[model samples]
Target: MKVKVLVAAIGVLAVMVLVGCGGGETSTTASTAASGSTETTAAETATSAQPTKASITVGVLVPQTGFAANYGPEAQQGIDMALAEMGVDSGVEVKIITADEDVLDASNTLERLKKMVETDGAQIVIGPVFGSSQQAVAPYLTQAKIPWFSFLGASKDLAGSGGTAFVWPGADQLTAGPLGDYAAKTLGYKKIATLAPDYAYGHDSITGATDTFTAAGGKVIQQQWVPLGTTDMLQYATKIDKNADALLMWLVPSDAASFVKEYRNLGVKIPLLMFLGIFDPTFQEVGDLLVGEIGLNEYNPNLDNARNTAFVQSYKAKYNAIPNQTTAFAYTVMENIIQGVQKSGGKTSVEDLRAAMNGMALDTVIGPATYSPDGIASSNRYIVKAAQAADKTYIWDPIETYENVGAPK
Candidate 1:
């Protein structure tokens, strides 16, 4: 899709007046100045004082192929929607360039990112979905001096001091920590177990949950890691400690659906507490089996607020599908960047944009959010449970909300 340009009325009027005036001959005369003083013309001073119009190239790096491809299109949709809303009259011309960040390999993703910055001249980068991909390309991004707004939820280092000003939608600790507290303190699950894909995100998520759960006097009885793209989860399912109070786990949507089905078939009765992934659009395919499963996330389609309501309505009207976390993340990132650019008088420089973005607070579809000095975002999070209506459609019922959730320091 093309980026729609919406010119401001005042800008249009100015252009029209300039066109009507036509060209007129003018004489350039040097004016006298005092000793040790530099003479400057009124026109020269005015031109020099004007803020330079910014031309920004944004690189959209998401997995358009491989396991995570399902999310890439929606991410793009969100980007387009945000840009359209910000309009082209913000004294900046934004050009979007896209490249696939293949989920199976981080090296390829890094190469693509390097090409985007060095060859495509992308001043800002939006994503490279998976946790490992983000980690691999982080140092390169820092060296390139490109600001990245990532959807990664794995490493705290990505948002730590002295690193690239990389922003995340919501870090793993933000979602997992609250859910862990809810699981142990609220649901009274004293002994828990976890199952997750063996990667940085999985490690971060499990650690976050375990830390919070153990602190609340709960014990983690067992933990299992599944390789990415492992279709048969029966081995892991059979190993789950049935005596545990509950199982906390997450995987990519397809793998998760398959694993849940297999686990259910294996007659594992431990309740499931999920961290992200489960609320994906693919969850509808296994809704009946997933009923009553609890999860935590930063965004949900059913959130009732003016901004979310309008966003959901517009997204559905345009795409004919309900929006998911990926869409929300993409939209929020783009909106934040646009706001930063505006704050800097359309300055696209990495240093200037970073200064403008740090400590910015905005009310987004996910509710009020703020960017920390380290570039991590803090926002409201929801604890949701899957439920099926009489019509047999699944809905994420938000049972609890945690405000201003951020990554652990």
Candidate 2:
């Protein structure tokens, strides 16, 4: 089953890439200084005024082939969509550097980052998609002073750590708060147990959700932390065979499916809820296991907006499938960068680009998004339940919405 699934996934990705790059033009440009933005006296200004280059090079690093590969291609697709819509150019060449986060080890992932910065000449870096990989790469990006836009796991360590790294979405706070509130108020779940990987990403997510839920009068009965890449979660399921109202599960596609299957096998029939990772297409392979399951999304593709609808349609037409948060967030990252470039009139300096990004607010396909100086996104989050109506297709329907956290008004 594993081999067959792996082969099928590869085949699907090959088709998606060709479709993604087809619509976009070859966008690039050279820099020209703003009429009056630089601060310098006449003599000092004469020598200090260096023209703003029109071309931009963004380094996109995601786990395209490893554990987090599910979201990697979707991230690239989002970037491509932004480039097509924004039409940014100035003799300004926008070059993309794609790197794989070999989730098998940290050293291999570090090597990938070094290649992106040194050999690829990617002045701006976009991602290192997994929490473990992000932690491994964070210190290096700090020393290099390279501006990186994080698009993957919402680890608290990345927030306010004071480096070139800026986190999109309040990571743990954004996802967990809305979800916990819904589980408490709407579902009336008095007691819940969280099952997640025993790592920075999983631990932080559980902490964030349980903290918020408990504060809202919901009781967390237990917490289970399993090792990453564990094939069987039956032990975890057996542990949860008790009287909990719901299960807050945090696992990638493979393990998530294992949890669902094991829960059913063990006759543990409580409601299952998951984080953004549940948005992957691979979940569909489990069929009935996901029906009626609740999932929280920082980015929901079902949003009834022009950009979002178009994104969903285009993605479906190309891949014959729907998109998840990974795709939506990835595309948002690229779109934000494109907007910054256009606002800067094709400026290329890392400092200038970062400032422009910080100042500008973006209307994303999902919703209104703006980055705080602390580098977290202030945006709404949605509580979605898996529903399949007469259409015979599974989709996420929103139950509640949460406002922006960790950002100033």
Candidate 3:
């Protein structure tokens, strides 16, 4: 779906008056010529003085099908809502062009992104949700000079001198650091096992966990990397080291649910610690089996800040569903972009928009957020445990907050 701002044509009517002195000989042809010249000049002046209507075309590249299909619609909703709030009446005409980021193939994702910019005429691009997909398309986007706002949290390389500006609402390292610290220092787990999908995100998450865990005098007893799209997690679950103090794992929501179910079925007695995934909405689906599981996130639907409260209320009112991380991050992406656009007076130039966005701070649903010069986001990260609330619905109850967690340097 596309959001477009329609521009109206400006019409200028030029009128000229000619007068003749009573005693002087009058030349009608000369007078008429002078009148015509005066009218032409007035018309030219009016045309030049008219404000130029800025057409801002945004490209949304997301997985509309395959494993990550759920994210596309949720992100779209946030993008739409932000556009609604910005209003077309701001004198900037906006258009949104969407392209599907095919989850299984990086080449296909790259081609779709190219089309968005080369064929669809998008000035700014948002998303290509997964880390692998973002990495696949980053160089091309940078070469094309289109500023990218992404949802992928796994890679910090997406920011800095030669990279696309990242807009991950929360960096993976931010949550991963706290998760590791909590597991090793707070919970006092000495031996932990790690499992995750075999990809950039998996590697990044484990690194984040291990860096802190080891520093706090904990050891990773076992590490397993599952291939993406693996449906049967039973085999991997059976291989988990039962001797470990705890297990730290992450996967896409569906895969995570499958893994947890299999782990229980196999009677793996190790405690579980999670990152990024396994939160409500997902938690609501698997909460009965996931009680006591700990995880980290940037935003929870039940977070008590005024910004978050209003966001949740508005989101439920519009979509009749609770907002998830995808929705919140996508909303923040557009909010930041709109703020930058307004700062630049509707100018969409790469340099102008980049300068406007860099070091910019805004109050988001997750609370106060600021972006670094390289476009890495800094925000609060919450440590949570899965449990049923008084309403019998599953929730991620906030246990602790790491304030103003910045992206990995």
For every candidate in turn, the CA RMSD to the true structure comes to: 16.1, 10.2, 18.3
- At residue 183, candidate 2 shows an lDDT of 81
Please give, for residues 267-377, the per-residue lDDT of candidate 2 as tens digits: 778888787757376656665667888878776667777878988898888678787777777777766666666666776455666667774667777677777655667
Please identify model 1 stretches exceeding 4 Å from their true place: 1-52, 152-154
lDDT, candidates in the order shown: 0.74, 0.67, 0.73
Q: Which stretches of candidate 2 lie over 4 Å from their true place?
A: 1-53, 88-92, 159-161, 345-351, 406-409
Can you rank all candidates by lDDT, best first?
A: 1, 3, 2
TM-scores for every predicted model: 0.84, 0.81, 0.84
TM-score of 2: 0.81
| lDDT by residue (tens digit), candidate 3, 265-324 | 887778899877464246676788888888887778878899899889999999988898
Q: Which pairs of residues collide in candidate 3?
A: none
Tens digits of per-residue lDDT for model 1 on 257-376?
Answer: 888889889878889998775748688888888898898876888887889999999999989888888887788787788788889887776677767877787888988887776777
Candidate no. 3 TM-score: 0.84
Error of 1 at 190 (Å): 0.5
Candidate number that wins on TM-score, 2 or 3: 3
